[model samples]
Target: MKIVFALLWLLRLLPMWLIGALAWLLGSLAYALARERRRVGLINLRLCFPDMSLAERKLLIRRNFQHMIRLALEYGVCWWSSAERIRKLVTVKNLHYVTDLRAKGEDVILFYPHFVAFEMGAYRMNQDIPLVSVYSHQKNRELDAQIYKGRQRYDNCYIVSRQESLRSIIKAMRQDHAPFLYLPDQDFGPRDSLFVKFFDTDAATIPGLSRIAKLAKAHVVPVIARRVGNRFELEYYPPWENYPTDDVEADTRRMNAFLEERIREIPDQYFWLHKRFKTRPAGQPRFY
Candidate 1:
């Protein structure tokens, strides 16, 4: 079984388009056969977009499946593609926004949600400015090893484990790094997270960003990478310059709400497969 898995991993390193086609086929098959996830996807969509009719919800669900597959393929291709080739695929804007923050001696925390070209955006950012990034480790040891190799391809990238505390991320910023890039949308277990309202449903959100930003005096910036005209647009939203909130939970909730707004704008670009509303408050059933 391990041998077969390793062989498939090797195939993932093939030319970009070939791997993309394979992932599309695999995703379509999964969407067709995985009744449980498909139902969950549809349910999640309905809850998020209550105004949409049945046909509209179904269309989004199908597109979401294909988007998931394309994203899987993009991961393999982005890691293997050269700088020149990768540049052609993503168009970046607001570079000065990040640079200006760094110039002011402000260590920034870039919050990115799970998007189709997320991995590619991570890679491209490191090429421009080395960042200390935190990545979730895969269960498969072999797959994790390969992923680490791909992440380290550029000059300014570093990975930290979840076991590491907020101080570690602060230290990375103190080293004059670009940004401490991370996604806070996933479930962070029991003690590591708090329930925050995302898209009208309570979702687990990591408070690490708020704590670390307060401790290090770093600025929190929302960054998103979405498909635009067959390429990508990596945009950096300026920090809330006039922010008045000192409360960690309130600030984090506001940041997460901003992410939810972006997701609504481009529903198919976000990762719907993740059980976003996995941990619900008492009396509330799991939404996905």
Candidate 2:
């Protein structure tokens, strides 16, 4: 771990494009050698894009590994770089959704998913707006401390444990009037989850998008973060209209469908390394 941090510190001194190129090189190696991740990414691509040709899938698999590697390497920048430096690297589009809403004293629920550039965008947002989100403790002690502190470096972020009740998250957001950075697309077993169609496949998804919004009385604004060439782009979409309509299942399905559209825009940036369909219905075969 000491050596890893030292290498990251060294890498942080280099130009971002150079770091990006190095990441691509490393990712190419991983694509060739890391059988399980590559296989999982390919499987995800196949499932999500059944209409694409085999050759197209192969190309996407390679590029997705490259994007995944870039995500890994950029963590150093998010951790160690100054706010001014990061500002130059990250550019936002449609940020008025955040500024405008905050001006009106409205609590916003940032509908963020597990995009590759998520950390960068979150780090940026944390600088100006107080962000409250749920986090699971990292397994590594030193790395955990660094991550926790790094995320709160701006003194404008609050993170609760995943095990905590939603009431606590709601209370914190209401008090701070902070934007809740919610990521509800990923699976968390069957508890508090419902099977929703992601790319037309039944995926175990959190039903909190609508519930949390209703509980917090917040506006739902979808945010998309992506790596375009050397820098990152964070786009804040318009707020959802008439959300949390007393139909959790219908709301979750709509959220998943929106994710499908964004993923289609940049298939590689969407998280594909994980076993997305890991939890199946009682008798269904395991995805892994």
Query: lDDT winner among the candidates?
Result: 2
- Model 1 residue runs over 4 Å out of place are 1-25
lDDT (Cα) of model 2:
0.86
Give the range where candidate 1 is weakest over 10 consecutive residues by summed lDDT: 1-10
For candidate 2, report its TM-score.
0.97
Residue 168, candidate 2: Cα error in Å is 1.2
Q: What TM-score does each of the candidates earn? A: 0.89, 0.97
Backbone collisions counted per model: 1, 0
lDDT of 1 by residue, 32-140 (tens): 8878888877777776778889888777777778777767656645666678767777788887778998888878888888887787787777778878877679898
Local lDDT at 225 for model 2: 88
